[model samples]
Target: MPSQEALSAQVGAVYTTSTGAPVAEPYAAQRVGLTGPLLLQDFHHIDLLAHFDRERIPERVVHAKGSGAHGVIKVTHDITDLTVASLFSKVGNEAPLTIRFSTVGGESGSADTARDPRGFAIKIKTDEGNLDWVFNNTPVFFIRDPAKFPHFIHTQKRDPQTHLKDADMFWDYLSQNPESIHQVMILFSDRGTPDGYYMHGYSGHTFKFVNKDGKFHYVQIHLRREGGAKSLDNDTAQRLAGENPDYATEQLFTEIEAGKFPTWNVFVQTMTAEQAESFRYNILDLTKVWPHKEFPLRPVGQIILNKNVQNYFAEIEQAAFSPSHLVPGIEPSADPVLQSRLFSYPDTHRHRLGVNYGQLPVNAPLAPVSNFQRDGAMAFNNQGFRPNYQSSLAPLQYKRKAYEDVKHEIWLGDANVDLSYVTELDFEQPRALYEKVFSDTDREHLIYNLSVHLGNVKSPIVKARQLSVFAAVSKDLGDRLAKAINHPSVEPLAVKPATEAIRYKLKAA
Candidate 1:
């Protein structure tokens, strides 16, 4: 046998597969003849193909295309009075965080510059536990009820019959459900197609924040990009969609690699229980927003992305987040969408990952875990020979923390009904957004944007119906859209079909 040093040097010169078989040539596959089919006997080729076949896991239902980076969330201001969440306990404290930015409806292969709301999700690993603030770039969403979520998303996707994106499907759904107007207005505006991942705001739909002494307040988290929001025009975004579909993803990764780390200032808008009750619009409604005049943002911390994942699938795809994974100082509110998501998120992870998905290194909590649950598929870290149950003889002890120790407010409401309804207040924000918030230039761009998409609808009825909703928001908005689409005298349609007599009377000389 060779000496130890000589043996090590010889071993280091050879390359092998996971099974320790030396790979003679990695470039070519073994074949029967020059142009013949590959040989199955070649284990290397078989292994490569087998791994490639299963390379793709299930893509997310929404926010499918995204980019993620590792960062540090540093508390700049002391909010210990508001919450005892370790990440925000004191100034100068920092925690490891990972953030993902994405287009809400696009696929993994879709254009990065598409005109859509960006998903701004952050996962903070604190000493207490992991806290996830899965937010969106837009402060409000398209619908208030979780039941409508599937339907609304379907409209954004390709039509089932044609397998192509349908303008009629998009407009018809929004026309039928007026609650989508606020998001629709924002989507048509210039801000829809952000310049890149670095430019946008993040909003946590449900209020969730807690302080020391068990006091809690309904809070909305905000992440304002240090560079401020920027966007490409329709022409530029469309051109880039054809030329470079992954422009935004490449931009983010390259910037970070070049040492230009992106940062955002985190803030929160807080509301007391009485304030939530006396609000003009339902605070629980995800489609609406609490005006800044009443609830101003309070600065708390900053987040800076300093590292990139070495492997996309292992770090980004396998990383799981859920609203229900709250730490001691945080809790969920009565927001219906959020309440539904509390269950849906973990359920999705179980489906996509294995039953014991949390055991994965990416999703695992830093804190120790002890529970009665045991024995599922892919149980990599199954406690060896330990009784996976509560027992007296085993000397396993349980500590019960006081409910009051965690920050949460008790609500007294009937839990029997599935509360879902569209109210007149649904249109308030959208109307004000169109009239007061958007400037003349923004309004002009909105009209141009709406006309570009709406003009493509083949059905005149669908076009008229959608225009009527626009008219309901504002007569000028309706008139402008109608004019842009070459229908100058478009009238608002009735909620129900009009009778022949009613139509005749209205049209009478």
Candidate 2:
């Protein structure tokens, strides 16, 4: 660890005029006479206010509140045949990593214990490049369509007129979009509010793993904490939210400082092109998961966070992650949501940070960066005098790797255009998830949780719509939820609202 004196030297601090002359006194401003108007020529005063006015950059639009740590990712199992990614090519290989955990919809000052999905993002500084796994604590998401993401996130945010969280808007969106029932079920369970940063799991939404020969396979990454997942009940979480809003962040930092590092086992489930073609569910759907029985987890590596960031603003706030930052062996899946994020993540960084944000030490790649692109805001590490453009005089050399080993599969349907549509196949996995995967105790908690949140929604029409979607998942679940909320069965509600009647009957049947 660098000492305070060393760090201060690295980042200088002195009250000086713009011309570099040190000010004799910083507290008092220049005045023509005692209690007279201040002189306009006081450069020190003018510069102090000018710098203070523009000190802060734009806050993150989402995941604004977060905690980060420095660590090392150690490869435990060799899967060189699965991925040509240098990080996983050799066993015992260690790469410097920085991780950020955050609440999805909260502002920079919001409570950390809110009942929201946590962002588990890791940036690994590998020799090939910086590979970032921008994931969430939950394995599945609410909707698979990238178009609906903005709508779903809107419901989680404040109301347009009231500027406060509105339960009606939330239930209304969920009820209309029946596909969200699966994620809703999981969120209402105890897993929603994790006990701390160390007691949760991380999952890569779309698979992107490849082999040494550039052969790629569809894969999902999982990180299970050594201590196992733990959670706080609604009462406890609410109490702590009021008492200590930064509980999770403080706990994570203090534990690392005390030498009690948290570790997670990394695993990946792989699927060949042929396997994905005939899979029961759409393998690319973000809302569904491949059955573990069919594709077992293959051990890949381990991540242990031992170092806490000394400066949150420099390290954590400026850290960036993007799905587009993939290396040679690893590639992206055809998932639309993943495809959209490939553009969105970096664009947001450009808005929040700057075009040259990657040049920051926290986000810079470990390997040498040589490219034709140059000269943007904060051009700190510009390659001096290097050819900024490829030309005959430069005599650029290119190395082409053979793509013969790359897996190829046939596509039967339309290859282009927006491929977003709902089918009966979409409900199959959610149905199985609700009926088979959850235990009796789990089901009770789900019902109780749903009732508490849904009970607060003012619109009876929205409540009925949500109940109908729940009914589609399971007749018993819908019936029980209506009973708990003091509403009749779907048959009665169907008669009152004829338009909604058709939608409900289709789901109820």
How many Å off is the CA of 24 in candidate 2?
Answer: 4.6
lDDT of 2: 0.79
RMSD of 1: 7.4
Give me the displacement of residue 436 in model 2, in angstroms: 3.6
* Candidate 1 residue-wise lDDT, 1-509, digit = tens: 22345567777577666588899787789998998999989888888878889987789988898888889999999887777677777799988987788898878889999999988878888887788888888888887678888998999999999999999998988888877778888899988988887565656475656665556787888888997888788889899999999998888888887789999998888887777655665566677788889999899989999987776777788888787788877777767788889999899999888789888877777766667678899887776666777667675666442236432233312221233434445566788999999999999989998899999998888888889888877889999999999986577534332122221223342
Best by TM-score: 2
Candidate 2 per-residue lDDT over residues 174-220, each given as its tens digit:
87776676678778887788887855454546555766456678788
Error of 2 at 305 (Å): 0.9
TM-score of each predicted structure versus truth? 0.88, 0.89
**Distance (Å) between predicted and true CA of 220, model 2?**
0.8
TM-score of 1: 0.88
Model 1, residue 83: distance off in Å is: 1.7
Worst 10 residues of 2 by lDDT: 492-501
Candidate lDDT values, in order = 0.78, 0.79
